[model samples]
Target: MSTQFGAASTTDDVLAGVDLKGRRVLVTGASAGLGVETCRALAAHGADVVGAVRNLAKGEAATAAVRAAAEASGGSFALIELDLASLASVRAATDALVASGTPFDLVIANAGVMAAPFGRTVDGFETQFGTNHLGHFVFVNRIAGLIREGGRLVNLSSAGHRFSDVDLVDPNYDTTPYDPWQAYGRSKTANVLFALEFDRRHAPRGVRATAVHPGGILETELARHLGEGEVEALVTSLDERNAAAGLPKFQLKTIPQGAATSVWAGVVASADDVGGHYCEDCHVAEVHEGESMDGVRAYALDPEKAKALWARSEELVGETF
Candidate 1:
């Protein structure tokens, strides 16, 4: 039970000495960045990994390293087509997964879009909400039955959740002004809430869920929408927010370091202890009040709000799971 890892931990550090010969894992957005690193680490430890990506052509090239790593550990890796921006793609991907009859030991909702200019997904919901929250909501439910009893669901959230709680009543910004950061925050909050409700409902079945705020942000694909000046402004904003939260000075993390918390939540943490918790820096993060960064907010972890959001999501997606 000792916390053997920290912000400096890597995926290999968390998985060291742990055997995953027969384990199955699925990582969303595995075409590049943290997703690629996560799969490479898992596959190197003998876990069969499926990397879900939006572009199969690009994904195949991206996952080549993972496949090579699997060879050394007697594991395997493959890419599956998945576009979170499109519900049809989600369903199609889920159908393929179910038909394959693979009992996944862990599913990491790792793909996300951040702070993009105002837009809607193909499904007509706000781009962030639709792609980051609702897309995973439907995809996970469709594959829920395939997860083994002792499996885990690792939902990748962000420190940005502190920016705003989800405006459930008008999540799509129907009447409100569209602020990109606020929308991203709302989506990240939904990620946390989803993990909360998911753990509440399924923990008894021995499948636990966790939401992770991977520390140390850097320029990643998630920043695709930011222009040159905007990126610099974001860095300054993050530092100011951390100071306001009474946290230490901020330092951007390399991809491997940033991916550590999610990897820990997915494979290293004990299911019974970590389910439904918001994690960062390889441990449970504190809930900070009146802060726009650094830790989880109370609203994101509220059970009642989680349930309400779950229901709203079901309605938005027009299906009951």
Candidate 2:
């Protein structure tokens, strides 16, 4: 039986009585929203946290806020620079962290861009694909050595992955029409595939990985690219569908609520032996058969495809496992 919690759970609720003293954790995009909450919760539980962010100013402010929150709650925190859109930035940040020599007990790959317009990164890759997925791929491989035995890695995926997979023949829209949603979907799928492959390759060494859907929390950096109308249309559509299907209307979760599933996947006892599982609402997601548009897409879980993506990613980032 799959154990799952509902969207109502908060970070404190999920992490109740859990102690993270001496644990080292890295959370990307911790400037605001869910990332801030996750950082505060883990720090409050006694974990030493590293907030990896893009802008130094925003990062400093966010770090200050997190530290203040943690101190208010009696906890600790720090910050690091990591611009996921730039390969050079990723390398510089990785080199600094590696040099620090602090082995990470947990890594929450929580940074990502959502449905953004057509744009490329400094390395000439699609912005969404580059930052939301490729950057993380390189980041994970770079830090694979830092993860302690029994460490865990969590990738933040979304239901948006239902839109598509990596366009193997032309992943960068080099010869086709550029569709932002498709690109975002491909990136999210990559998140899942990355976790699956990472788990397969590292679980034997006592390192495990999981990908999770953090529920539809509208109040996030993920929606920064969407216009008010687009956001309203998407939100309305989902709400209407839920009503028609007799399901609960999608509600914007509090930051702590949004961070719950991630915390659960990162440290819950019930998930001790669970790796390579796509999770949501604090539990292992069921394999959906009828609709390819919902749940775990086949390509996302295909070990062969996962391996292939890893190889291509290595080539792109010039990093080898």
Candidate 3:
């Protein structure tokens, strides 16, 4: 496919002339930030949207715009309860979906925690890894059958994935000291690897999967874990580094811009171009090395690493797909 969209494109921009009247999409983390915008954009294009949210009350309140857009476009929006931090909740929610037997054209794993303080999930894994990766790992695999052939899965990874690779041996930081950024990086990297492997496993059935980095967007709840001035400080630091390297200063994206890539990869782009890859700014990213904030790291897309992480994830969640 020709590249027509770029970094500044919004969800609406990507879906401008697309029609989705008979399609169904499932978006996790649909209550806030990029998730909400993704749902709204797809629904506005006439897709039936199921938003999987952790808090029903919060989701209902946050998705009012989504509902209105869907109503106006002849689409529909509904919320399903799903808490990624707990295995029990993941199982229950997925089981119900599977029982419903309704097929989905796409699934977006957009829920995740970023730079959180050290903690563990209900199932005893590190908080970030558990919620961001393992939880979706099981959730998606459980409903893999519900995804129609030729459907797709878009995992919301991050540019932060360059910070570190997954530590399969010490996933919970059992021995190594825990650092919030590193933990978040590991989880984000796992997101990419998960997509890579899932695409490989399901591509034969015409179901594709890919991961996306939504670009930095500060006006969202994702930064709540940051200290009062930490966001500002981080941005300044990044700008300084970029200036030293003769690169443009770092800039944050709007929620719509951040969500553009997700919808693009899941709906607009050719599945063959995006399958088993990591995408950003509405395009497939190249494998880049070093400390730059632009492209996916090789380690994140290593097929061997993806396979290992998939196996380890199954072990951790006590489930296989």
The TM-score that candidate 3 achieves is 0.99
Model 2 earns a TM-score of 0.94
Candidate 2 C-alpha lDDT tens digits along 1-321: 335457788898988888888888999989978898899889888888888988878878766667876676555688888999998998899888889888998999999998899999999888988998889888878888999999999999988777888876677788979999999999999999999999998989999999998877877778999987998898788787767766667776777888998988898734354589898777777776433323676767889998999888887777787
Tens digits of per-residue lDDT, candidate 3, 1-321, equal: 649899999998999999999999999999999889999999999999999999999999999999999999999999999999999999999989999999999999999999999999999999999999999999999999999999999999998899899999999998999999999999999999999999999999999999999999998888889998999998998888778777898989999999999999999999999999999999999998765778999999999999999999999888878
All candidates: TM-score:
0.97, 0.94, 0.99
In candidate 2, how many clashes are counted?
A: 0
Model 2 regions more than 4 Å off: 1-4, 72-75, 240-248, 269-272, 289-294
> Each prediction's Cα RMSD?
1.3, 2.0, 0.7
**Candidate 3 residue pairs in clash (backbone atoms < 3 Å):** none
- What lDDT would each prediction earn against the true structure? 0.89, 0.84, 0.95
Residues 269-311, model 1: lDDT tens digits: 8887679999998898888776545668999999999999999
Q: Which stretches in model 1 have alpha-carbon errors above 4 Å?
A: 244-246
Worst 10 residues of 2 by lDDT: 286-295
